[model samples]
Target: MKLIAKSMLVMGMVMSLTACKKESKLNPIPTSLISDASAYDSPDRIATLVNGLYATFKGSGFFGTQYIYYSEARSGDFISTNLNPTRGGLTYQMTVDPGISDVSAVWTQGYQIINACNVFISSMEEKGIKVLTPQIANNYLAEARFLRGLSYYYLLQLYAEPFTKNNGQGKGLPLRLTPNKGLAEYNLARSSVAEVYKQIITDLDYAEANLPANYSSAALNTTRAHVNTVISAKTNVYLSMGDYANVIKEADKIVPATAPFVAPTGVKNALQTEVTAIFKAPYTTTESVFSMPFSNTDVPGTSLANAYLPDGANATGLGSAGTGDFYLFEGGIVSDPLWKTTDKRRALVFTTIAGGNKGRQWSTKYATGSPYTDYVPVIRYAEVLLNLAEALANVNGVDSRSLALLNAVRQRADQTTTLTASSQPELISKIIHERHIEFLGEGIRNADLMRLKLSVPAKTPLGSSPVPQINPENPNYLWPIPNTESLYNKDI
Candidate 1:
């Protein structure tokens, strides 16, 4: 059933991509057209659709690859050295134009998943599958809702201005709660960030309330949405919303009283003692909250190795991340830090200059084994701890608990030293620094700056010092609504 469902999901999304075409000569009908009755009336198909939704989430267009890479590159974590600059979002080469392919792919692919969730949710509620128990059905609904909320979160971050930037009134994604139905459904205008966030909170709130504590099946465990999974996502949402108190409230649900802090959902997550092992395969670190895994057989088409590591860079024969475009800094905090040169986090990526390239220090985090398999970590427990510490500092002006959380993450990276912050602002600064170093290649830098309303201090391969900052007031900070969307949606 899993295999068949996985295959169908790939086909399902492929068709969705085809449907996104602006113009075509042929009038090809969809290959599989199961009506609401055919899909939802059966318990088996309903179960399969739930898994299929995950397949959509796992797609390269989403979390499987592009989402992570684009976020990292655009956030100024790495400078693009490639001549053409393929991934425009990473280097700020693309314009705030409606027709840009890179930005359009993100919009189209995100809505594909969003619409898939809408279909599953509507069918389950309207048609009713008799074979499953009530608890099972509710869990499925919770999972669908979580994914919907998650999809919107990513879209908003990329396409809309930061919620905190203009008091949440910026043009946001079209808040489509129902299953898509042809051009009519597609032709809608943007919602305000505040409005979209309200919907996201509503969906996630239900997910947190009804989702199970955990699942026994390894496949069904952390990969699926449980209460803690929902909480982890909600913490992220609140953090993005700049609701620091709510961020603390949501994070507290997962954070532990001490080290080896296992979540209430039975996820035994903590700051990994060894920094390098965090990105390795089978990805069950003491710190992973939610991760999307891919093996050799079922790969995220844009594998991180292929996107970050250059050719001949990996002697492991696994894969490459890009054509040597992704370059890191030797003098920056990423490699040789101004504060702590002995930090294990810096040492991990700089090991062998990230598989030995001539003019660049790259990342080896994704270049795992032969055949190059690794997982995309959607959220980590370490981030939650950092969020908690930052929130505490923001709320109470740097207390013992906040400082301890900061020290815990930093010390976990390098046990020989502990960090100190005399004031709330100092502690918040330390917490942000910890996040940057801790999640170096993991792609949180862009979002961190967005929520803080700070200008992106960008650099280029050709230039020496930083480029003019991409400011908070600029439209380039957010991607434009696609030409496809504007062509169809009159309100756009």
Candidate 2:
């Protein structure tokens, strides 16, 4: 029954894509048409439709470019490197648009996905499918909530200001649960960031309560649906809320390290323990709570070959027809030796390419299969440790555990010696800086910068001198609602 509903949904989406004729511009999602109650009566079909909800979040065109990579890349962590100089300037504008294009894409895609999930949940409830127990049904809802919360989290960062509410209150994207049928719903105004966060917490709590401990099957666990990803996501939310204690608590729920730390094995670039293993693609190491796996077949442009395939570079094995996935430091800024040499993060994520590639040296970290095989990992275990360390230090200042966590990451990168102990404030500042360096391209830096109430120093590498700063006082931090939405809705 679930399968049938899923097929129908896929068919429906495909038809819509076909009618729009924009399917080629983006990856085609498997959609079906389950229009009436008669088709939904079967429990199996209902389950299938629920399953299709996961596909909506997969690497579609808009999702791949806007949500996963471009959004994070445009933030201060990375400078624009062009594979095709003539046409790449606009791509570089992502950094200056203040994430407008990325934010708009996220707003559209997230709401589309949320409506799908809500529809599935509603449909499943209507069907008396004892197929999954109540706990299981709730678990599905939790996953939906988790994804919705995540979308909102991104929106808050890109569109709203720093969290200033006493209990997480501030203007945030409108809370849209059901699909809007007309202009009335579109007439709503922005809610506070605090209000948005409360919903995020509510969704995460629901997910935590009903999700399973772990799933053995990689496809089912990592791809289909499982608990770890949701937990990892929850940890991210905790960090965003400045709730360090909860970050530690939620991360532990995923990987309970009975021992202090374990060394990484197998892969040459592996991290120290099973927990760290999640960072790598192979060996479903105990650490990965939630990661969007990119297969040569599953995702549209996440392969290494596609990402790294130079604009005119040959297609080595699979044919010379793919585009490069990884972006090198082309602005001459990403190569600053001080941070580049001392901080091993550059080496870890980007592969150094020589010969003035597109006006400056370039490298590749994603795009394993050439022209696009790069898998986009949303949440990993390493982040958990960093979050824990940062949170621990923030909550209680620099301590042994925080030091240990920070050292573990530094050691993994084969970077400089460990940081000496410092005051709570000093340690917090250091941790924040390290995190910015460590997670340069992963999309969390802008939020961290805003949350800490700190300013970006005028630097040449990624940001220019007199850095474009954002805080509660800066209207620029709060992106203008897309002009299209503004025209459609009178609230603006």
Candidate 3:
């Protein structure tokens, strides 16, 4: 996990905001600063602070890299050839111990981003900013709040029980809403899951009302917290909360059914065609709703492809399976009849001996650049469609609408073989299947198991199955809160 080492004082004292990689090349996080009075003296300085928020997102701890690695390793999507994913090796399968470096990094880095967001949010509220930069400050405040709420949303999923489990009354991360003014604020206690969700919803609600609806720049629209990002984030939060109604409500903004799906800001948020093309390389499509940007000069320490591909000396891919660390369970979607023939998705996986791993199957999604520059997709338009489909299936059972949505995704990879299911349960099953294939190796698998209350099927990294069953209720399923917070925060 990566953390920007900027304090609130650093935020205000900044003279220039480093331009992001969206428009041009991305440079490393800039550490330039002056003093608060001079910083906020101009509206441009405050704008730079807002850019700093995305800078945090670019950190390796957040979307820059490890977060995706942690999520996928824990999830069933990819089994590791190495025993310990935390160490340079692969996962030991959700280590019972909380001291896993990667896990700890995730916690520490997550909080770092949270703290950064808090500082931005609280700093924007200063009365001086109201007089000098009300509009810019409000815009940035909403953006910061949206990003902060999204961070908490991710943390709650990994650290707390699913909201559906106990109506969200269970243990949640400690609420650190205000800026960390001093060491005294570090002692805060954990908030209830419902409380966290409420705060998340509150922040996002404001973001929806205030954040710019559209940006002409794809970099700003997809990489920054615009209306689409907020909508995507809200969909994820509600889905995790088991609030199907709201999931549909948020997803509806991006699903484009018969009409062109657009963000609440009136920006076109629909998926781009050519499923393989969308992910084969970086910045491939408009389908990417929200993603973290990385450039050659400022690449995250480890690219997402590191463990998945045994090539790219710059990649941290640990791929060592002759067949695949994750294999088709057999007689199912992985072995779909079309896979042997026309399925374009199947082509992305190929066998090769590289990086000391022989006959390992690797996904080409991250093979774009020598060092693997594929951007991390935090939210995709396809996920929105699937979320909406799942919500509708659960709400109205199997219907034409849900079927159409599910089929649309299914047909994306291979239009020749459109799929269908007989009931709501069947349709939901299809949606899950589609996600596994659609998001393979992207880090969505394990979390899906936890939220859907599904079991993790043990398997060799070679894609062989029938290892064992990890019940969804296992405590290991929920990552432990890092000692960084628990040990320091007495309330935790």
Best by lDDT: 1
Q: Per-residue CA lDDT of candidate 2, range 1-492, in tens?
A: 133213322311221211123432332111122445554565555555555555556534333535545444434444433423222233334333423444445555666566565555565666634565676566666666776677677667666666633446656776766544344555667777777888888877777676655444543444433455666677777787778888878766643343354323211122343322344466344444344555444554333334433444432222333354444444333554434464555544333334434232233334344334344555555677777778778777767777777767666664566775668887776666567555555556666766665543222343322224343465544455665456555664
* Tens digits of per-residue lDDT for model 1, 291-366: 7877667666666666567556533333444455566655445643434767666554533334334445667777
Candidate 1 lands at a TM-score of 0.88
**Deviating ranges (above 4 Å) for candidate 1:** 1-37, 83-85, 89-91, 94-96, 217-219, 258-260, 313-322, 330-332, 351-359, 369-371, 460-467
Please identify model 3 stretches exceeding 4 Å from their true place. 1-37, 85-92, 131-133, 257-265, 280-284, 312-341, 353-359, 461-468
TM-score of 2: 0.76
In order, the Cα lDDT scores of the candidates are 0.70, 0.52, 0.65
| Rank by TM-score (best first) | 1, 3, 2
lDDT per residue (tens digit) for residues 22-88 in model 3: 4112211221222254554555566666666666665677676777766766655454554544432
Clashes of 2: 59
Q: By TM-score, who's the top model here?
A: 1
Better of 1 and 3 by lDDT: 1
**Residue-pair clashes per candidate:** 12, 59, 20
Compare candidates 2 and 3 on TM-score and give the better one.
3
Give the Cα error of residue 263 in candidate 1, in Å. Answer: 2.3
- Cα RMSDs of all predictions? 4.0, 6.2, 7.0
